[model samples]
Target: MVFQIAISFSQSIYFPPSNSSVWDTLSISRLGWCPDKVNDFYNYLDEQQTKSFILLKDGKIVLEKYFGSFTKDSLWIWYSAGKSLHSVLIGIAQEKGDLNINLKTSDYLGKGWTSLPPEKEDLITVRHQLTMTSGLNELAFFCVEPGCLIYKADAGTRWAYHNGPYDLLKDVLESASQQNINVFTTLQLKIKIGMSSGIWIQVPPNHYFLSTARDMARFGLLMQNKMVWNGNPVLRDTAYYNAMISSSQELNPSYGYLWWLNGKQSHIKPSGPSSVPGPISPHAPEDIFTAGGAMGQFVSVSRNTGLIMIRQGLSASDDLSGLDLHDLIWERIMDLGCITSNSASQKKESIHLYPNPSQRYISVDIPNTSPIEAKIYDLQGRLIQKSFDPKIDLKGFSKGIYIIAVTDKSNNLIKIQKIILQ
Candidate 1:
């Protein structure tokens, strides 16, 4: 069964009129952002070869700027960022009863779709492809042919960012829906949301999507609103939507259905060995998720701040999928809204985690507070346990990693730490 995450939030986001070509915009100052910081943000983005940048608040454009000869109408490739779009199409197919993500992919693609034997190939599922857990080998060049789809492990036992399996998702959608991808997207997504200027370009065995910056922002808004277009329910499959945004597996907590999630205790980079010991985007909001391409193409959303940040252009960051540049942009964006107080900044937390890779229990050197409480969360951001005592017990709990959050009487977050159990 799909875990149903409970989140309570109400935001009346502004939606552009369905028949109009114009968009409603918000001013930076009106949103409490200092006007002077705009230039500094621009300078950083410009030096990194940024072509276009757009920031939206509550579905309204707040900051939109184009660099060099690029304009609002310029078309830019989303590269691997288009993976998220394919995820959306897959969701649509599931909703229409055309396909089921839990079913074996060979059920739709037929046997011998992969280099593996028929029985081994049938073990792969649509959900595995969505979560990047097909366990396919990532060493070879990008080729979706059956000969190139070599098996590295059984599906879902491991998570690896292999493009070979992902690129075939388009073929799966075509076979299941019996309709061209462009026509399906136009009818199911574009017309409902009034989005224009997006098209898919196929290069040999790979597919790349291109669209204007505004169109990217529109796509962000659609997902930000839980896949609802204005008053219409575009993909009313809330279970799939939740699975798409929440952590898909324990191996990489920072990934969700082809999207890069921001807030998790630990993460594994694409094809990286072992697990990195902290949140992927440490400086950004814990709830933010992103869709990105090579260089710096991105579409990021943070429901906590009611923000949708987008960027496009070339860059030198070797960290493929544009994660490096996007994190830098978020750090600067966090500084835009307000000023900092030196007095409060000087006070650092006294808490510390001992025997970090502990096996049983742990303690902290925390300050006193009225009704102080400690909470534990899984990588999916779900609350697992809580305590009122100083010493927290971990007996009987599965061996892995978890996030500990301590709060005061007024519900103020005092400290957060990532702890491991071995």
Candidate 2:
């Protein structure tokens, strides 16, 4: 009986539209984009290091594409972009009355909070950690050398991108939740915002954020929505969101929480373990913020345009240096207002596709007692094929990721899970 119910549920699953008309209707060029600008950016990305890109404006997807083996559902690692997730979750926790940033790290870890000289250890607060000003000695956090790991200064007296300070936040969150960071993130944030398939650490091999580029865009939208989803505020505080978006310290105009700032020189080292790369151009505004990852994974949020652009892939370098891509994205964003009118209506139906990681012969099941429209894309938003009825076969397809979105008579939207053919 349980198997029957499970099969029925699978048979009735619905897929939504891949692109929202609201975003398609906007005049993106007037907002500052030159004609064929996206193509130019895409070309550069191909030349540089990018696998997937998704652009959302005002809660609608403007542009989306995949390169190489990526797709709408491919779960690329977020690298340090995960740091921004840490900040936002902390904000949510504080608003939920679970923890306080004003408290010392000592409050959670107690004596474990110090490897430092006593005076310095006592002064560090959770707030200081959030701002990267905990002054916990760069060498201690880096330095492959052993004796090099000693506290050298007072807390909050300097700025350093030490991973230790950030890692400590995981402990703080866990202490408050009595659960691991993965569980906390899943229950409190991901599922609440309609993200069901996200792994916080260890993607395939190593611990990393494993999520679709679309889901990353959704995360960005949730932030853009101010933690509100489906008319409800999922995050506890607006002030926290504001702070996350702004410069958290006077020492860095380009750093906030664990996210990266786009606009000015923040005295970043750019080469050492603590180094943060400066911008490539001066025309870039200081108002932009991004969730940066090790590869080329980026979720850049622009305050000027209410835009969120996410790019996921391997950027083939070591030191943090990828300003040109951000610049190109902004140029495309300048074309975001009063342009075209998309004639597509809201999709209000449901369709289902199954055996997602199929070796061959995938199936589609629709509930309507009536018919539904379905389209399949091969990770790059390119139409690979279309299916009209309940069952579509994929016998000749290669192994990769694909997205199946469905629409009904009224044009409602539902995006289904990733189909992996391995």
Candidate 3:
């Protein structure tokens, strides 16, 4: 199927100039987000050991924050998220007629890549590797040696998150493209997408891609735009791109060519024995997909909202896979009202705050008949003031953006508005 760019956002998307770090930033208040809520979100991230976090709206930086000594230039490993990188490279290789995923793994690696007898090895194709359905013995874990690749079932019969087979794609790409993985990635994806800081470094059983948070956001934006970078086709194989992000097999509906998809009815998580009961992230938009890795690294793209969020740092929990932290970030995002789907009723019900750029005071105009209470917060999600009156005096308040969360007596969020104090 032809992949179409159906942007639902009202704002025009922005792309940073190639080979430059220059990108425009949008005011957080303009997005109708509570600064205090945003602050709270960051505090949660910091507590979770987040080194860097970024949120992009319409391809422009809405929020970019770093914790402690971490800076924009600090390099971080993507771990298994780099699996998605390999998937894209394989798509490009196929588009160039250099390799076909349908071909058997032995076609490129020769017959002895696996200990499984020749016939059994031949059954494993590049597609199986991409979909994590190689059916290799789970006992092998991270082992790729032939002795460790004993056959447990027919290729494509099962789905298991084995890193060994997936990592072999780098070798396949190297052989097919007649170039190093890093060089091929740079020429094909990094340079084109302005991922100036991205680099793939081989480390034993796997290859890790290291990049800055902005560069990771650039890649997420590329995927958000359906592999198109600044109107230039980065990977024009629409069919492959579509398949890469959609359900690739029946075993794992929430996985697509090494990428994790949200909103699917059921999903089999990494190392889990069976499929789970619900979507990967219940709080995120239904159309969202993600590239997640160890240590809380993530690049989540929401098609419904035209938003891309990236997080990288130490693990937030004992789970090394970081899926739990990924869901937690979505919860915080939901609280911040970042991805709330806008509707006509919602717009009408939205409270209006006037004299927004006021120096000393601001007034709230509620359209609903229900009595409302207001609480004010600063950019850090800190509650600074509370008032039941429609007009609040900001006489001594700091000169900056403030978030006013309006709610009913039951504490249900009625509306949120951002006002600027000069």
Candidate 4:
């Protein structure tokens, strides 16, 4: 019953804000949903043992709530999501001219490190360590043997989600930057991006991180803008940004350098030492990427839509409790202009376009035309052209893939089509 409702709710749901931050007493309503929608989502979280959720859109706080002891200043563990932080540090290290990603890990860690009888030390590269395909077995994390984590398959030959391989990534960054991970993150990223306040680390009894839901949102937004904060390019490498979002392994096409790509044709490997049995849809996009952690902690970003969303929860693997809450939260944010869907069904059926992939000349087709409006945008979501008419020539348009969307009288989703002008 829970699963059925979850599927249905995910299919169609929207949230509309009842109050405004522009004023006060801001209350958002979930369109096409009942007040119990939020309650139901919360109930589901309770069932799955979730903790907190923070949803943001357009760099504004839309939904911020917590459960149990959670609060506006509470910081939860990011778990494996920490790996992404490590990955970003690598990029920063490169920007600062520390170490190159193509270099061998042994170069910094020294020549004596090896688990492979005697001949595999030179096979591991920084790329292998970042992608978790360094040929190290899952057991390497636990093996106390001299070089258990350093032996076996050669770099790039095998793909495994082993901590032993990725754990070294932190070491590489520290070695390259000549500073600890925390200090580097603070000075290079956190402080630069104005996120130094939300940083923390666990030293046995204390939590590893201290951040509010909004802080996570900021982090997600930074990724959405390709590591640009406040109009400044903090990352400095669009190529690394592209690589960060691109698939890193054949085993899981959804897995990028250290981030998780949604909507990709990929599956999780079920080989060995994994919590999940098979690859599962994270209900995202091939262009969408995220930082996911144990339980339900998430920082999802969509470069296409320019969206940043954050969620924090505590649950077992593949659990749907906290996820339901997140779904409802998303629905509300969508209504508030935080998320967008570019589907034909969401638009009017009366709008049309001609010369789908024209070199220069094209026409805008509208039925009973209510002053059909249209705008063209590139894959990077940049607006290049705009027209309002029944037939407008595209002699001035550039040659590239573009999205031509026409809005109707209601200002809702209208006709949106892909135009390739060669």
Candidate 5:
């Protein structure tokens, strides 16, 4: 458990009035960004149906753009991105002695919250739910009922991304704190960080936090400073804060507690635990951690560069992980030739496969490696074949989904890419 120390900010760090609309902003030209490229970026955002976009450097707004009828004060849903907010609230609850994350979740939700037997269910802890390793059937996904929360594996053994387990976190917070989640949010977090406008609204199976884009920026700024707002300690627990931002488990090094981390050696998505060989946003800073949601809602914080970005939009892609939108934005921003805060982003190893969804044969390209050995596994994790080279012939295999696990000479996983045979 690595603890984080607060970063002391100079007077240049600006904080807005707690109840006012006034904010300090820095010009793009002053930041040495190409004026034409900055406008083109706004055009790209508009073309992508972005409702709002906010960029901050050193706590001062750099660029804030709103599209269509969405004004600066318009409220938008954070969708799954709201999970990061709960992550912070959970830390606060622990800090106040209201709950211990290691305790059995059943201690608060009461026994038989899931269909699993008490002995097996007792194996789950609040931390398991926080990290999305609850071992609950991800097929149950949005269903939070007891019968839907059946056992899939022992807790902490498998890592799966699903919302049913995460949704219960609100209940845990409400139960442990003995207060309504909204009330707790306002008192413990929202007001403390000048983000009082945000509210959790239930839209059936899933609950979302609705707030303005600037309000989202406020939260991101708070996180960028390691949970401090203008030197005011919003979440004073340094250990929990560090743990929340750091990798929570090994199954997905790209994930923290409801937050997506960049620069991990490997990453997996909602598709499954088939690891991909790079950070989610290859064009972004390695220290950029993200909280993203369905469609295109996200808050990305660059711990190394003091950059905080919030984007709210609609995406046509079925990527619930929001990886596509996050990467697209960074790809364009990095191409702007304005900032080189993290130049090492250019050298990250990203996996590429040729003619994906092929029926006969496939070739893999993994940069800066030799003798790219691969293991082909079925959906049930049964190893079907092994290849000494980077090519795989799917002649005898049926048309279905498969996982190609790339490993080092020692058989340790270096990458795993899910491919389709058709």
Candidate 6:
């Protein structure tokens, strides 16, 4: 089936053909990105184990690259990122009057949904589940059975990323809507937003969704437009949409219903107890929010830039939340200087750094006649060392990944390369 989508900029809308192969493209040169630098960015993504990457500007395809054997039609799992899909469906159910966030989860799932007593169990509401504040003990966090849901604190008092409570939301949605999760999602979201290739798969503890890279981008565009698609309202309730992307609770200010929000003062991870300082992705724009998943799956929406970025593949790190990979992508994008007017000319000169994964020292080769400076920074953007010498010592450096940044006389970043110290 052919699905239509609308890309809006200011008051203008562009509708591309329904054919999947015919996406509108934006000029990389006009965007001030050097083609070679963009290739370097893709090379970095490939080295970091990305399978598919797509970037949309104003709902038009700006960059789309598939690595190795992965193609445009490849169906990949979204993992926990699918939670955002569920969150939206919940909003639709509320808009249809089939479910109410204010009502207790027990009202729909019955009183025995949790092991807590009548009074405590009744306190756990659908809203609490959506906010990751169900206050249920996370002993066997992956188990959604009643016996596994022991009480810890009262609902809305604490925030913990527990999957059991979140998984139960599907049950709540199913029971209240009197429709299967698949049916509800199809009728409410996929069909409306031109996510024609998406499908949900039942996995233990969570129901994961799989789709082509373009379909995921379609969902990102839907979010970028605030739940509207092709000038049609997919989600009519603006208040709920705002809440789903804003702070849903106090404990994790960087988290919404199931989305990972940027620009907050502090943020917490899935298994972390304390909130960390700074935005989830310091290199990304503050207004960006994302639906992230295990093994590097991401659907990022940035309203300020009118861009939607989607990535899916094996993770470069073991972190299930893909925080490192997410930050790395944004860091590379910033290094590309895509939005800068002189970015193309600035990237014209390429610097070669050698002996990567070095044991002791590395060398830099600059083609420019002018003197250049090199600075080494850790993954957290902390400067480790700065030097004018071609050969820099790494004998005392700890064993980890570090970025080598090269700047010219004007202090413009000409090249950035990642190296591992052994």
Best by TM-score: 3
Candidate 6 local lDDT, 5-123, one digit each (tens): 11122223343444446778877654556577799999988987889999887877878999999999999999888888889999999999999999999999987988899999999
RMSD of each: 7.2, 18.6, 11.5, 10.2, 12.0, 8.6
True-structure lDDT of candidate 5: 0.80
Q: Clashes in model 1: which pairs?
A: none
Model 2 lDDT per residue over 325-411, tens place: 556555444322221213321122234567677887666665446565566654323467777765666667865556565655554
Measured on C-alpha atoms, candidate 2 has an lDDT of: 0.62
What are the per-residue Cα lDDT tens digits for candidate 4 across 1-422?
11111111111112222122231112333222234455665565567565676554355444566778877567677766666777888887888899988888887776655566435767778888787777877664533233567555777877676766666666677787888877888888776655635564644222245565655666776777678776777898889878887888676675778776655544453233343422233323225576766666778776555445677767656431123333344444332321133542444455667777687766766556466567665544456676776565677664555656676555544555656677
Q: Give candidate 4 regions above 4 Å deviation.
A: 1-35, 142-146, 196-210, 269-282, 318-422
* TM-score computed on alpha carbons, candidate 5: 0.78
Better-scoring candidate (TM-score), 3 or 6: 3
lDDT of 6 at 413: 62
**Where does the lowest 10-residue lDDT sum fall in candidate 3?**
1-10
Writing each residue's lDDT as its tens digit, candidate 3 over 1-422 gives 00011123325678889877688997765665657779888888888889999988788888899999999999999988888878999999999888999999888888899999888999999999999999898777787788888888999999988888988888888888899988899888888887779888878776889999999999998888889988999999899999989999988899999999987878998866599877787656567788989888899988667778899999736553578788888767755653233542274376687887899877878776666678886533446888888888887895655667776665556666667777
TM-score for each predicted model, relative to the true structure: 0.79, 0.66, 0.80, 0.66, 0.78, 0.79
Q: After superposition, how far is residue 320 of candidate 4 from its true place, in Å?
A: 15
130: Cα error in model 3, Å? 0.2
Every candidate's lDDT: 0.79, 0.62, 0.81, 0.59, 0.80, 0.80
lDDT (Cα, tens digit) per residue for candidate 5, span 123-146: 999999989899998987799999
* Model 3 CA deviation exceeding 4 Å by range: 1-10, 316-320, 338-422
